[model samples]
Target: EGRRRGSRAEGGAAFETARCPLPPAVPDLLGRDAELARLRAEAAADAPGGVVVSIVGHPGVGKTTLAVSAAHELASRYPDGSLAVDLRGTDDRPLSPRAALEQLLGALGLPARQIPASEPEQSQLFRSLLAGRRVLVLLDNAADEAQVRPLIAAAPGCLTLITCRRALAGLETARWVWLDPLEAPAAADLLSVIVGPDRVLAEPEAATELVALCGNLPLAVRIAGNRLATRPNWSIAYLAGQLRDERTRLSSLSAGDLQVRSAFEMSYGLLSPSARRVFRRLAAIPGSGFGPELAGVAAGMSAAEVQVRLDELVDVNLVQAAVIPGRYQLHDLLRIFAGERLEAEEEAAERSARSEELLSYLLRTATIAGRAFDPPVLTAHPFASLDEAAEWLYREASNWRAAQRRAAAAGRHREVVDLAIAMHWYSDGRTQQQPWDEIFALGAESARALGSRREEAALLNFLGWARYFCLGDNEGGRAAHEAALALAVEIGDRTEQAWANASLGSVLTRMGRPEEALEHARRAVDLSGDLPFWLGQGSIRNVLGTILRVLGRPGEALEVHRGLLADIEKHYDEAHPFARRFFHSATLQCIGLAQNETGDWPRAAETFRRARELFGEGGNALEEADAALNEGRARREAGQYEAAAECLRAALRGFTGVAAWWPRARALAELSTVHWLTGDAAAARRYRDEALALCEELGTPQARALACELA
Candidate 1:
């Protein structure tokens, strides 16, 4: 009953009754139950002054629809009347406070001639009219706090709900409610309602994908639903496939006047020119989110200036702050819109140049960060500390990964190979192995394309490590190392040959062929003897020690490992801090393994614990997890069940965090053994079952062997 009704007088002004001009509630409004409840509760709450609540979000997020619906539901509480007005906040000219007061006055049955001349006077007169009345004032699409402040009623019983694209945080007295895109299920339900439930039910997978392609924004979903509903003959999958292309996604989201692009255009048109430039250029960034430093590079602005522009964009809902502080992201649909603007307004040469600038910055910065983990003392770099370097590497990983791909695609072979080679040592400590596989594959291809045999051999060795250690592909690792060794020999690159031989030794050791692995390990050691400390000698020694331990020569392995540690200590002062910690940790871990094979459980446990601490200090999460596993095994053998369980759990956490399924499975199996030893059969069974499931999923030799032992 929020409709305006009365007979028109001779002057054509309606002889208004108690005014209720609220729009019709959207029937079965989906995905806003929580918001509606909060709005209604705020409206009903008693305050000294009238209650004012602002609903804020990006364009096409249904702020107006929600305000209208809330107003209609809460109309009964405001028995005197309810009034609504569109402030056109996203328009070229937003409604001024004076104009807004005039509209409210007219809605309250005041004649045009009787309205006050000044905005302050009009606001006073308007509040005076509603002083004792229980009215709901709905200011739809408010431009800012200034436009809303003057219009709020002074009566304590009154409630004013203002909706805007901006947050209007300056309204200190108002309670704020922010809207994100609908949740996936709610979005799917909304689509199900718009398209027949039967159709959605028939193609549930496609329906889910279609709503996701819509970015879960209500308006976009409704538009897609309408398009699908009208095209009865078209399958939902076909429509989803059409929208999958980012180049035409916005175009496909349009159905008549209901255009997602048009909705974005209105908000975009309101941005300052500089903000507009930054917003569009940000589409060049590859990942879902990016930090201010990268944005600064893209916009050619100082970080401080870029932050200011980012705040401006955030206020208007053009950009959103990510879960991580200081990072921002554009909505999927909005990113597409920005890309469209980038192509349309920017010159092709200019776009290419800007893209190259960003890519160059990403690669160069990544190289610097990666070097912090490499051998020898780290040279002068922008990062002030090892932790800062690591943080930048992980945070900007997506951006730099994309840059690598783009560079490779553009045939910038030298740059791609350089980045890949720089990341070799850094990749060892990374959380996931898959990224290294992709990176090294590109590096190898680029090196081959450039006909740089030395680089090719080096990248091939790195690729072998990735396949063997990261991916658990032993045969693939063996093949890659063999190929690298052949190339190294062909070119007479002794350092590359040494690394290739050591990599082969490690892979062969894992393949259950310690004898064959010993040959490779010994050859690698011989080759490494004449090379520099950082040129594979130290690493080759570690590989040799691991092989010696596997071949039932723990005493010899211990000797070799001790010698490696002694050598590392001599050059310790010359190594980067991260390299020092990481190498010491690695060597200690090898010594611990040898100690364990020699049945010195106590010493092995202590060594592994120290290695774990060193790995943690070096920020090598996966290696820390490995150290934890080793410690747990030693502790179990030493009859410390409680300590073993604790260490194993820590290992599980580290493995799970990195999504290292094989290692996680091993941790689970170890926990199962610990639990069984502690007389917890059910716990043991549960852990064993979980481990077996993962083992089956991995299908690796080690995984299968563990699975069989448990079975």
Candidate 2:
């Protein structure tokens, strides 16, 4: 997928990438220095309708070559990153705007769950993610204006370079840089680069004839150069004789599918059956990408068998499997001609049916596997195949993820939601936010169309969780949560309501209304009592416990927490790492707070020590810092001034580099008391004042009081 950033056609490489930058080498670059400069000058915009450079040309006129080169020239200026996408505009299907955005989000390293399911949200997010980053985006092989708009970035300091066969020169502020055929001299230079200078120098007359016959197209000239380099004994005059015939002239460069069949046949007729089969079957792909699948469907062979055939094709330079671990596309002109062969020389219905079959197979598998991971709550399916379902979902994640957006274009909402939910397990580092986000967005539309408020509630609930927990957009999170809750109430689905409650609790937590968050959590837990595997329960308890301790209700909170810990150790899998840590943390914090409130300061300090150790085991630095802060306070209140200083310093050591923002104030406050006790009244006053300043800045009430009244 030569997947570049920003645009959508290509596969996304994971957003926020840190790969080795493109090397100094750039190829097929011609006559664009002035165009490049003009583009750079017009790249910036404070608002929408920024400079969109469209390089239009006929097929095989080197549009992509120039686009890539121009983007390369402008790469360093955009520090955030650069992106590229090949819109499949030339073939039967064109790239959808949402699919393109999804790929771009992945390449940009946006989270998979964060991708919006709706086109508008995807576009909005595409712009938002690009808003502050200085990135150069190249959209190559685009079909039309509608396909390009959603992926366009209008942010200042960001530039967009688009290459299409048609001139969308009408778009505002878009500088059109049309790539005509290369000049004979430039074509001659390129030919020289491929073949020996001596070969060109030896046949100047024939070389001029050759360039003329190629329509001065770079791809054609390059193919001619390759043929010449290999056939050292063949004279240019002999080649010219073959080229003089228009019937065989373009065919002279064709090696079957390697170049263009006419061009390739001109080149390919020189090869055997092995190469021809490789070219024809490769052209039969339904998707832009190919692997063993095309060889299986088109050539009626397995992956391993196709590899041997593909190797022969690659050896003759008829195929370029550059899409590591997958087969690749033939060149634009070449694919066009091969497709023509597939139409005339092969059965049309068979190929079309095969294409549909492949896509359907992908969707069905994606749906089943997706349902396995996140099965419908009220559905009749028991969701029992633990291994097969999960295995299938994991294996076909890419196809289903792609299918959700693909189906959305045709308004297939059920497939969109079903497919996205199946991909829950691997929705982490790879892929991106737009794919799933758009899935839910479309699912919302689909639910409305079907008049299924329950479905709408579920989609909104998923969207709410995604926005709240993944992206940290509190207002959006709150709205989505409310929307989900209202819809759930309308449908009278208690389970959906339960999820919405948990989601609302999350938003309230972020909104700093912990009291409301606790109430919401308690309601969700009560609703979840009859349900199975409510993962959110533990998370809710963790939040509620923290809130209660913060609100000075440690006694009530401890009784609830002790039972939770006991239940975790008894009914839950204690061998699970997360389970062990959760129980350890709840036990330690609740007990520590209760003891501290009851004036058993030594017991409070000891309990905090255990919590700190457990967090250290979990590699949870922030939680460890919290534990240390608690013990430091207990020590200071107990009048163990030196120990209090030691505990605060230890907390600082763990939190100094990390953003332990809330605990930093407490650590400073405890440290100031030590200073006051150690006979340094000036230092104590200074530390106290500094702590108060930090507390005020972060809006932490207790830290402010401690700093103002104590040390």
Tens-digit lDDT string for candidate 1 (1-711): 000000011001222433336766787578899999999789878987899999988767788778888888888898888887667565434666766675677666654333443466566556656766788888887888888888887678999898887889999779999998889999899998888999999999999988877777787777677666766887889878767755554444434222466445545656789999899999898765698889999888888999999998887667888645798877655777788889988999999888889999988888778887665535455688777987888777768888899899999999999999888766654514125677999999999999999999989988887777655578998998999999999999988888788888878888889899889888888888787774567878888888888889999999999998898879877766766687788889989999999999989999999999998987677788899999999999999999999999999987765445677898999999999999999999999999998787667678899999999
User: Whole-model Cα lDDT per candidate?
Assistant: 0.78, 0.64
Candidate 1 regions with alpha-carbon error over 4 angstroms:
1-258, 431-434, 565-572, 576-578, 595-711
Looking at model 2, residue 388 earns an lDDT score of 62
Question: What TM-score fits each model?
Answer: 0.60, 0.62
Q: State the lDDT of candidate 2 residue by residue for 633-703, as single tens digits.
A: 88878888778788888886665434343466667777887897889888888877877766665554665
What would the TM-score be for candidate 1 when compared with the true structure?
Answer: 0.60
Q: Which candidate number maximizes lDDT?
A: 1
Q: What is the Cα root-mean-square deviation between model 2 and the actual structure?
A: 9.4
Per-candidate total of colliding backbone pairs: 1, 38
